[model samples]
Target: MNLNQKKSAFIALGQFLSQFSLDNSARKEGVLHNDLFFDKFIDLIELSQSHNGWFTPEQVHYAINSWAEALTEENLNEWLSAYDLSNVQPKTVGLILAGNIPLVGFHDFLSVLITGHKVLVKTSSNDQKLLPFLADYLIAVASEMADNIEFVEGKLENFDAVIATGSNNTARYFEYYFKDVPSIIRKNRNSVAVLDGKESKEDLVALGEDIFRYFGLGCRNVSKLFVPKGYDFKQFFEAIYEYGDIIHYEKYANNYDYNKAVFLMSLFPLLDNEFLTLKEDSSYASPISSVFYEYYDDLETVKSKLLEDSEKIQCIVSNNLINRSISFGKSQKPKLCDYADNVDTISFLSKI
Candidate 1:
């Protein structure tokens, strides 16, 4: 599509989002947000007190919109137009979807779609419908997109390139299975925070969204923290305690209650904010039941630790890091241009 066409299409899609209000419809259909218009996708989070799944749907909506904005004809000409899609061969790409969070594999799917390659998508049973609905929406806007898309219930092996995301253990199988193909294999990665100890209560409360949203289920969710020595947890916890209703999930409630019991049994030190369960640990990610924190007196020391563990840390949330703060909602707002493992997916696709 040309720049003018792309921009025009984006306006149309954005307006459709406003008019037809798919988000409101999605909220009603969504397990999370069943009533409020603004509550649309934010309500579907499995464990947290459901507030429209914390934009599980709206985030997806904005991302696609952002992509449309960025992929205008002029932008494409600057970055992608020079690359030849016609002479370059088409690739058959296989996408293995993960339902750990909603639309987790959509980035890979978008990479395959936008790059003029064929996608063999393996949808997660837990999230069976969203992709199909999204694709249906896109196909209406771009007719050729359908020709390049395919959804498969089972797995397939023969392909030109692969992008697989799983745990550190499953990465071994991906590496061994797709040896010759150009691939990006991803393992567990979580976001973190390095507090300068000067954050305002308002920012700290917003940071709570980064930590507590989705009950810490996503890569962008801060599973761990780096704080100054003897930092008080009072303001931070109180800022975010209003989200207490996330414990409404019976299963999540059980896990939180169980972890609390275990922490008590082990004599672990914690701050029972009466809302969140915070414990001491040197970890990058947290489960639905708990959040972890560690103290560091030296800023340089914390920087080194963050860099050394960048492989494990997906995002670093802080008052000073603007880029990092932008990712605050990344757990929920993945877009079409973002490839799994942060790969240059369009570049990969142009070659295919």
Candidate 2:
């Protein structure tokens, strides 16, 4: 299909997603192919947890809502207006997706096909169902999309270039294996927040959304805190108390128990609020149930340290304390143009 046709199809897909929400799913009239996909989608959303325990219905719905809001005609235009895709030749782009969060690798999938290239996707086992189901909806909306999408079960070959997401160890394998072709190899990265001890209670409550969303699995989740020395945890803890119910989830509770036990046995001091634990750690990648924190004496030094460790960082959440930092609670809600690892996927696709 042509560019406008492709955009129209995705816009329809977005409309279909918009029908469902965390509070209630109100099926609206005029949505395409709902007779075939809508009820089945509800079933899939309910069935998702059985496929992956972390894929709770709430988390899955949140992901769907984010994508629905992102795929609007205006948002799509804003994101793609910078690229020139008119004269591009179609190459098959192979994708090795990550399953850390629901539909995590979809932007790359959309980028490859929307740029007129065929997509050969190897879905992460943890997220094999959702994207393909959506692809089916797209094909139904515009049948030509069928020719542009493929899912492989074995080795990925016959593709001009590849984009792979994985841990640092798998990245080495991707680098060596795809060394001959142009590729984007992604590795582990974590986000952090800078607190200056003056943030209001509202700010800290919003920051809880950043920490608790997706159960803290996404790279965009704030996994660490950079707070000024002698900062009190009292206000921060009280502000996030609203999210204490998160501890009631079975898997999260298990993780909390196990990780907390490990920390206690290791004699690491902790600030506990029954659900989440705060530990004074220099590392950015914290365990699932905990957030690591470092006491900083100078904001400028923290800024310099973050700049130096830029590669390991995915996002910086702050109240304008760090230049270009994402606002509190906004990290996980990245716009379509918020490319991961600061790598521009659209620009890469246009060139390839």
Q: In lDDT terms, which candidate is top? A: 2
Question: Worst ten-residue run, lDDT, model 2?
Answer: 79-88
lDDT for model 1 comes to 0.63
Name the runs in model 2 displaced over 4 angstroms. Answer: none
Report clashes for each candidate as comma-separated counts.
Answer: 15, 0
Looking at model 1, residue 198 earns an lDDT score of 79
Clashing pairs in 2: none
| Model 1 lDDT tens row, 125-241 | 666665665566556676666766788876666678877778899889989998888877888888787776777877777777777655667787777877889898878777777
The predictions' CA RMSDs to the true structure, in order, are 6.1, 0.8
Question: Best-fitting candidate, measured by TM-score?
Answer: 2
| Candidate 2 global CA lDDT score | 0.95
Worst 10 residues of 1 by lDDT: 27-36
The TM-score of predicted model 1 comes to 0.78
Query: Over the stretch 1-352, how does candidate 2's per-residue lDDT look in tens digits?
Result: 8888889999999999999987899889999999999999999999999999999999999999999999999998888888888888899999999998999999999999889999999999999899999999999999998999999989999999999999999999999999999899999999999999999999999999999999999999999999999999999999999999999999999999999999999999999998999999989999998999999999999999999999999999999999999999899899988999999998888887
